[model samples]
Target chain A: MHFNNEELGQLEDRYRAKLINSLSGFKSANLIGTTDGKGNHNLAIVSSVFHIGANPPLVGMIMRPHTVTRDTLENILELGEYTINQVNADIWKQSHQTSARYEQLVSEFTEAGLTPEWLDGVKAPFVAESRLKYSLLLRESQTLEINGTVLVIGEINNVLVEDDVIANDGYIDIEALETVAVSGLDSYHVTNRLGRLSYAKPDKKPDVID
Target chain B: MHFNNEELGQLEDRYRAKLINSLSGFKSANLIGTTDGKGNHNLAIVSSVFHIGANPPLVGMIMRPHTVTRDTLENILELGEYTINQVNADIWKQSHQTSARYEQLVSEFTEAGLTPEWLDGVKAPFVAESRLKYSLLLRESQTLEINGTVLVIGEINNVLVEDDVIANDGYIDIEALETVAVSGLDSYHVTNRLGRLSYAKPDKKPDVID
Candidate 1:
């Protein structure tokens, strides 16, 4: 099938959303946990998280315009802290439930039946069910001029991971933790490893790394 | 295991890259195809692509600083057009090979042994072997101040997908197309889907859709 810009723009609203969302291919399933500085906690499932850089250990996630409820973004702005919890197979359903539009005072941790654990120095809460998670300090937030979406960049403050998942060379075996991937808007998937390839060099084809 | 910011900063550079990259969870594997508007074509595998919005069908990708050979970013800026091809099992090795720092003027397509296919009205070439792909026109480019990385935003110009892979509701069954996901920096994966869940509502738990 071929869809030009006009054809794509003519698609029904929800249909276009699903098609365009899935067009980006598989996405990381993660819950962004934040607190309003008081006691209200917020958790929202986001697939927009992407690694920005490694030296400063930066990460970026896209948030829809604040035209509607944007508790997670607002909390991060208010406190400059948030937690990104990997949504594993065991907690994918609960993580998805966090997307519901609960009132500002209502905590998604309670509404979604997930436990929120607070670590020392980090103001935000982490999902206790998540095997891999990290705390981040807000570094920058910029709104794209073309669209109203906000780009939230954060620097990693700390990382908490299950011991067994880390390989000797520092690669986290996410498949071992059953970290799920999201496709489209609501479909969840568990990944099967297809061997790691050696670093590419122009002189030779990459071989499978042991 | 827990790693605070200081400890994380002290780790070896390559190890930290692997750890920090993996921290974002699973990433989509896509080949960015671009041309310098001359004869030189460039292809590179990128896992940083993320959906920005649906109404305008915007997609964002992070490009590392131009300290090294950044043919993809340069070509996009020069021509304002590019193609994103979903990396599949059949061509993942070839896609990975494109990351090698091939000198300017050498086409990765020729080096990696994949065919570059052009369609009507789209200047960039799509991977002939890729079952799903799309063309994009550069909409905006911004250099992130926190990190030297550049955020490249593009508007979808067109999409080409395998006919059978799209469902009635506009969800593209990427698993059916054998689309692969990347982990850390080198590992590739194929996914096994859990059922799609219905949209969340505050009143009730979400049920599996279809």
Candidate 2:
């Protein structure tokens, strides 16, 4: 559509789109489980998870502004421990619903009808339904300037994956998890595999992808 | 599923995807169109496009570590101009096919069976089919350590869009464009409007979304 620069900016206000996706597409985790030092467990859906570094196996997520009221942010800051649970289509509705403004003490797990299973030593609980869950420890936290969001970097201290879902190599068969991507908001999408582009190996022919 | 450190690291090779998505998922762009420096155009897809800053609107793209050889890379470096095309489900197949390594200098438009239109002053062409296209000028190139790929950031000097798409606020209604998003590799996705999040306006409920 033809729009002058001025016209487009107005849409930002009329539309109320958060532009939270400024990061990248394909959000990995629907729920981030965190806790406070007092052991209060809080759950929230985090769609901004991104890989930061591989050497240390670091992953990061952009926690929306003022999520400080939640426990996940508290746990990471106070206990430096948390877990990421991949959300699949089966529970995406409940997962997205967790975003509703609930009291700080309200347990989203109970609110969403999800089972929170605690790992042996980990403080936070894992989404029992999640095929893949990572028990991570806080690595670093940075506040981004453009927006008032905290970039939580975590070290993969321990990982829990359903057998047969993970290929021997790191390639995860997300298809097995049936995890979907988050669109603007309140929308969930089931992702189907379209075939992978061959790794740009030194001598391989570049294949046409579907 | 329960796995220890040794086992998880073992599967890292395949299961651990790389962090090529520098797209904070926030202020990123979908490649909206592509054209030859001389004016012929081709429509392709990209989600890794990001902005370095606004003073000049510097944008960059992280070519996948798979398929798609250095042609587009060379083309941009040589001609110094290329249009980034956005993909909607309407042409998701054609846009998805551009990931292929076609004959060198073969117009992806012809291969994908799409058309390209030229801009008046720029060397590269824009995808005439795109709801939005930004004509960018090369700015700076930086090589990322992990992937060995150089991220080319450009300044958006001009843009092309169908007349009706723009609003008065200077923000483009991308949802109106029905843009498609890329997941790990081959998946083409249609996004549904959720609610938009905000940076400064944390108090207001996210009632409006694209």
Candidate 3:
């Protein structure tokens, strides 16, 4: 529809909830600690994590702005690292709560009622419950002033998916992931894997025009 | 299905092909450009725009490494201003092709056979073909070293939707907008308005729960 700034002010929050609850139907994830450096350790549930490119294996994420202090922003700026920890339905609520304002000393893992683990070299924490925790290094971070959010780009250094999550050739099963997407705020959803379209190899014949 | 990095490495190209080619239906968009200083004119297509937050209305995009000189990045770095032009199915191809490495002096609108417009006080050129466009300012820019990509973040300042495409309360109809989407490489798709959802208001249920 249409909205003036004052009317559309809730756009981000609305979209966030829609994305999490409606569009995303497979899994949720947590924004963990910094990667290569010791910046900050923060936690929040994000339904947005999709690749932008494959040659370089690039991934994109939407980091909503902080109403208060943003630990993830501070940490990533200082340490230059982050881990995207895949969240199943079980930990979605707990992970989502990490959005709460907490002191630097407080760990979201404790507050979220979850455990934060570590990989040998990466600085970002891993959700102990995750079957696939990607230890990615922050290659770039940008803030879009229009939306008052931060888009963090990460180069994957290590993918710590449990053996069970993959097929022989790296195919990931949506069912196994059991990931949920957030639609509106607390609403959650799971989607059917509509057969994947073969984008790389165009599959249709050119239609004849009259 | 599951895949290991090693396996993903072998089939990465194939999956990429499928992934990109599969983008036959989705919301396609263009990133209008402006100088960070005095608002130099720039226009480029962007399928990478993504939200990073709700409260701040943050969004981000992955810019291919500077191998190709991009005025948009320059503007974002220099003046920190940009606009996202949402492309419909009608102009999706033209918008997508703006990624071709063209001369810095060459106007993409001219090269691609499109018109560039301006709005608000921003100097960036907008795609006349877009159904909706949002003017924004660069809040931050982070270069991703791991993937050799740059992430640009922008906050939305003003949004412009073609009168016909918007609903009364700020709903932008995708089906009506005829928005398209993109994938890995050469892929294009028009999106359908699957449904709508509302944000979490604490006092109310999300609009999309049904």
Best by TM-score: 1
Q: Which candidate has the highest DockQ of all?
A: 1
Candidate 2: deviation at residue B104, Å? Answer: 12
> lDDT by residue for model 1 over A61-141, one digit each (tens)?
999856323888889999999999999999888888888878889988999999999899999999999999999999999
lDDT of 1 at B34: 89
Kindly report which residue stretches of model 2 are placed more than 4 angstroms away from their true locations once superposed: A12-29, A53-55, A67-71, A167-170, A200-210, B12-15, B18-84, B88-183, B186-210
The TM-score of candidate 1 is 0.98
Rank list by DockQ:
1, 2, 3
Q: Candidate 3 falls in which docking quality class?
A: incorrect
Native contacts retained, all candidates in order = 0.83, 0.16, 0.05
Measured with C-alpha atoms, the lDDT of residue A81 in candidate 3 is 69
Q: Candidate 1 lDDT, tens digit per residue, B174-196?
A: 99999999999999999999889
lDDT of 2 at B35: 40
The reply for model 3, stretches above 4 Å from the true place, is A1-47, A50-56, A63-210, B9-28, B35-41, B54-56, B164-169, B197-210
Error of 2 at B113 (Å): 7.4
Please name the candidate that would achieve the greatest lDDT relative to the true structure: 1
